[model samples]
Target chain A: MRFKNVFSIIGPPMVGPSSSHTAGAVRIGRVARQLLGTIPNKAAIKLYGSFAETYQGHGTDLALAAGLLDYDTDDARIRHSLEDAWSSGMEISFSLGVGHVPHPNTARVALWAGERYAEIVGASIGGGNIMIHEMNGFDVQCTGEFPTLVLLHGDFPGVLSGITHVLSEDGVNIGYMDVDRKARNGEAMTVIEADTKITAATQLKIQQLPHMIKSSIIDLTLRS
Target chain B: MKYRFLHELAAAGQQQAKTISQIMLEEEIAESGQTEEHIFGQMADYYQIMKDAVNKGLTTNTQSKSGLTGGDAQRVQAFSANHEPSSGEPASTAMAYALAVSEVNASMGRIIATPTAGSCGIIPGVFVSAQERFGWSDEHMVRGLFCAGAIGYVIANNSFISGAEGGCQAEVGSAIGMAAGAMVELRGGTVDQAVHAVGLALKNSLGLICDPVGGLVEIPCIVRNGFGAVTALAAADMALAGVRSIIPSDEVINVMLEVGSAMPSKHRETAQGGLAQTPTGRKIMENLKKRK
Candidate 1:
């Protein structure tokens, strides 16, 4: 069922020695950048399990750096992403984590850009596929396969309805959704994967909803 | 919208009076909710990428970043041009092209992951070389890719396609099966034959381990792709000649899953055992670590 599209099996033209390490790492970084709404001035990446074991040989480091720089998976510039990051004033660092993780190919990326900061934990699940499992300390789940909206809001009544109402009003069909919170009446996160593209205008409308603390759209389809 | 197993796919193709390629295309359209033109166009673009990767690797002295693999594709091509290859022109050319794309991958050049990057070269190797020999148009190659995709889809969902999950057999073995099935279709074989080719190719690749030297995808990974393409070609030829697998294709795939799961963790891309633990492979790792 995961291999729904023929292209998922046949293609995804990429620069790679390994799809999970290279292309999937790029996607994880790209998602982090998108969540931050821009290329971060500083990024701290932690590779877990197999990603930690064979990252250098597979160019996982370069691919992650390139992703933070907004490079596509197939971009030839991925080979020189480290230099590019240094030249562009984007500080990036990597560390290997020795601990139990849900998946072997896991990476936790923390990004900082002036006053804005975001942390995302994701896993490269193979064949260039990824799943973002944690964001901003909230346990959420989403695959970057569709145009997704990740939102943080106060855990209050009507907050979820308010957001879903805006999306439904805009005629966006939700394909998959996950909601997680730390505690009752505390901070909460909602991740929405939509079948149709969520326009910038719709995102703005959702952002303006009451109790909305932060909102970011990670539309991977735009990468071409 | 999709067939979950090879038998199901074969049945659907037969019941619909369609080729496996057509059945796969229709399933894709249904699952993705995309128009036929849009999907076909995207596939055409992927085919171009595959061809480009093969061309770039064959024409250039591409070296991997680790310096572990490079220029073998060109060397093979040169040797083929100078002497009569024992494998014949088609097989030799396929081997060269497979090496080319895999070398390109190791060098961080653009290429399609037919199922996964470690096995990326097999489809393009067989497809491009066969295209050159048969003068098949890009459109025909695209259809062949759909056939390959169908086989890959089943294997990926049922068994595995990543070395970490199931060792090299899951990666390279699945690629060989996919390429063989697609070749059968491209050669105008029946759906049954195509499915049989998947079994034939996979049966030979059973128990293959994934132990890359120095943890890079350069050592056995690249050369395995070259040999995989040859196996795929032979499997297709056997299937077309009315040879069938005594064990069904689905059973073969299930056996692959069992075998791969029973394989040791060290042999599954960990670079800890098998060839990766040999003296030469250990030396390569030591050298790479010292350079770092």
Candidate 2:
């Protein structure tokens, strides 16, 4: 693997009850907010398997709430997330789902900001590391350990080429890309994972393209 | 049945009596200290002395602010009652909050950083319980500690302690297992029973998330240590009573591994899931960032 063993402790020490439940949840929530392109007006998250069974004990509920509100992992406000959520009038619920093949601590977060909507599914790999498994029914993957780009563009022959071209022109290097199809003629999802920065101008240009539904840039630089 | 339990338990307790200090020494081998063998020998000696202290009933039960007390009981009641820790009482209602400040400092000073600083309370909790309950010879308790060390080694090798990798299963889960196994040995349980106890304690908290608000390990992390300590004792007690788990230790370890792999990154320690996403959570982060 290009990354270190998922369990290796490479850097400074961490604060934890468990890295996945607390830190990973916080980052996932933050990523979900990024994918929604704004703080979620409301979010409904369902945790499958172990996450649902032990969410409260492990602080998963609080971490998810913190993530939706756009809190970073180290944000002290995370302690008060439940109270904040209750006061904010956000609807949050947890459910156990049947996803055996995916990671053990899988979670699906659906975010709504007025008219805008997005969903993300991700997993904690280990050692405060995470893998964003999918976004909006697309087979997307990113470590959330680096600065990443989650772009939703129209399905076209030249879409990938256009994205890479613009990125290359802007001095951004492509790390990885995944594409998922909803239909032959309907809207499709494209997730581009990159090692470089995705500027505001690039995001705007990409969204302006025909067939583009939404565009989001998620930065996971400090989260990993 | 009574004889069988006592025999099995005593045999298990004696299995690793001399090895606990050996393991602690080995854990510190790579650090900047004396030679590896020297450190190992020193740890072994310390283990023996500590064990002897227990045998002599010389434990200092100093009632350090970090010791488990009434607060632990209240937290257990709250968890069983499925009530959240009262966030309303920040500094006043609970004495442990004041103690938490000192506990963090003591952990930084006395205990070796095994996985995390926030989880420092577990080992001490185990030692204190052993001192109070059995008052066993230092050798016996030291062996018990060694047995716990073996369990920790297995967990470290098979899984991870990073919340990001496997959520809290790797951190608190593993810690609970270690404490339970250690307690089993001290209490004269067989190694198999020790393993079973460790597994049960771990399974109880499997998939627990590591969501520290604002990424600090203070809030839930501090309190969870007390719980892990008590649970470890409970697990050891169950094992001593011949309450075997349907699943073997190996199988339970496997389950933990699989469950951890399946956890989402957000659910780890990224502060992205659970409480990190709430409006108040966001505001807290924003406020902290602003302060920074």
Candidate 3:
């Protein structure tokens, strides 16, 4: 069955091992890392739902650790990734959350880097697919596939159109895009799913946009 | 040309070969780009991977045999001895190959969710048997796998291979088709026959459940791979020999998708149906779940 939003991009990719456990777990970790925005000085990952129950055997633990450390699925280092995460000063933990969701595989990883804190909640669809459902209490949907541009732009009219114009000028087609508002006159988050490569110039221009709050280009085209 | 099916099959074979080589290269098992020589080299690589896996398996078997003999020289000597004469051997036949596959799964293979660890045996069971009687080769066998991989790539691309969505059909059925098609290719059959063999393999196990006992890839899944391999070879051989199915390969794939959709959640590898229904199955699952 076809899925819209984050679920669509999450379904297919060339990844190592199983998709649901390995790929999904890695995506969740990657999201957590992105939310942290730096190599974590220290972090604690709590896996829930299916991830908590079968994390060890399914290699979900290693996957999360690898993502936090910025390792891709095909990284040969994944085999000994836990030690790597620990050596890099990342703290990890696991617990089953007391809740139910549509998908059995879900997780929450709370991260910290010297007081810079962020929370990432995500789900693993079957075959190693992952959807980042919520981030930092905001209902944000992002599939950890494709090269994504996430910008916290001004909560104002014409911001969306301007973003599209930039992409058009760059010859990048939009595969998917979504926006969420945190307030009436504060900041807004625009998650653009792109088919073409995001150049450095485009990233710099998006950051320099008037009233732009924060921006990051997340490139996920590297084979897992 | 009223030979639309034939032309399509030939085209499909070439396309299949290209895709399989691509995946192999992407997986870092082979290099990028190709000529006829490169394609053949990739085929050789595939052959060696299959052959080496089996060879590595022999080490464990030898160790186990040695342990059983407990260093008794006479016992070890007797065990190592080959007594049967080539003349006294039963007539080399396809049926013999098929039976041998069953024996391999039952006695040798560590099943990977209804797929034989020894991937080649299943396809060879039918392919080799038919080829012996009809004359085929290693090249045909490799090409069949390439085609099968193409079909598998599509399913894997479009659906799932974790036995979580689609079941054994996605794994063993794909393998069988590849094996059978290779057989057909070697025997000078048209590409339609190869694709049909894939369809035939998929059809035989459309809704075959993935009920690995205790969540281990052993027991019934192992034996099932043997059966799956033989079935694929047989399907490809029949298609090659000019036998046409009322249902086409594409239709069978659609059916597989439908059946997968209709299946109860319990049957989809939750360890809750078929063999998993028994008291013994429940106990095994419980024991596994209890482990950290």
Candidate 4:
């Protein structure tokens, strides 16, 4: 049941040398890009455990760069993503180690656009599958396995209800919900996994709620 | 979800009173909510991709970015064209296709990861070569793919499919088993025989490590794909010939899980042991670093 379709068993239709290191790395990078809502001018990638030991041979470095630049898993341009990033003036750097993360394949992808910054901690488990453990210091569980809507807001009573109310009003069936926060009345993240795409209008409506700072919709269901 | 066992596939076949392909088809339909025709079209598309990868690699002399893998597929095919290969046409063709796909992958080309990219070579190598050898229909090939996929599904759920998780045994080894099972089904063997083919294939691959020279999927990785394909054919033939595995497929899979867990981290695709530690392997790693 974890792998629901034949496609999961057969493919990802990817550019390859290795799936866990290449395609999975690209996906982690892509998810980070989508989370930032825009491509970052600067990115610092940190590979952990097995990823640290063999990033170059598997094109994990290039693949992650391609992903942060918004390239898909099957994009041929991935072979030259490093050169492309340099030409685009998108600053990128890589290092090894994500401090005690249990998974063998983990990446802490940090993206920045001047003052706007987001840190994504994710693990590319296997079979091109990934699990996002934390984002921007909030412990949220959102895998790009489904169409997900992630919202950043202040930790308060009305934030969660307001966001869900907006989504429920649109008749969006929430498959799962995770409300992760730092402390009481501090910053927070509400991650909602939905069956269908959440439109821009819906995102704007949710963002307009009090304490809602930002929102981004990650749709893995398209060519998903 | 309950179909995470090998016996479950046989049970699924028995419950529906159908072949392994039909059982897999029913499971796929129930899960994805797509029609049989739609699923078939998608599988056909994947087959096309696999075929295209082989075609592309066979035509090109381009080496991978690592410069370690290339030109071998063409060389193998040319050598087989004139010389009488000891393994005969089918094995040679399968090996050629296997190397072709691996070459394509090493060069960063688009290819289907039957279970994973590292092991992509084995399935296309065995299946398409068999089709060319025996004139298997597109529909028949599709059925074979489902049979392969069912075995992969069980292996993936029970253990893992990536080299990083369970070494090359999990990647190439699983692909070998998958191709064997698929071959049995395509050759009209019983479901029990298909499962037995899986066991017979994997039982030989128990301790294979994921030791790529310089951490690249070139050195032993590309070469292993060819042998893996042949092993699949051999396993399929054995099962079709009524050879039985002493251990069942279910127990064999559990052994894979245990061995993977017991395997040291360095041997599991970290490029720290086996061939990766050899003099040339270290040199290649250094050269790659300098180039970067």
C-alpha TM-scores of all predictions: 0.96, 0.49, 0.66, 0.93
* Error at A70, model 3, angstroms: 2.2
Candidate 1 fnat reads 0.78
The alpha-carbon RMSD over the true interface for every model, in angstroms, is 1.2, 10.6, 10.1, 1.6
Residue-by-residue lDDT tens digits, candidate 3, B3-75:
1222344464476753332333333222222354665555555444443323333333322110111112122
> Residue B118 lDDT in model 2?
44
Query: DockQ for each of the predicted structures, in order?
Result: 0.72, 0.05, 0.12, 0.65
Of 1 and 3, the candidate ranking higher by DockQ:
1
For model 3, the stretches where C-alpha displacement exceeds 4 angstroms are A1-17, A41-53, A97-104, A108-110, A115-143, A171-173, A180-187, A221-224, B1-146, B153-160, B170-191, B213-227, B272-292
Docking class of 1: medium
Ordered list by lDDT, greatest first: 1, 4, 2, 3
The residue pairs that clash in candidate 1, if any, are none
Error of 3 at B7 (Å): 13
Task: Give model 2's clash tally.
Answer: 86
Q: Give me the runs in candidate 4 sitting further than 4 Å from their true place.
A: A1-4, A154-171, A208-211, A221-224, B34-37, B290-292
- Separately for all candidates shown, the number of backbone clashes (residues 3 or more apart, or on different chains) is 0, 86, 6, 0
Ranking by TM-score: 1, 4, 3, 2
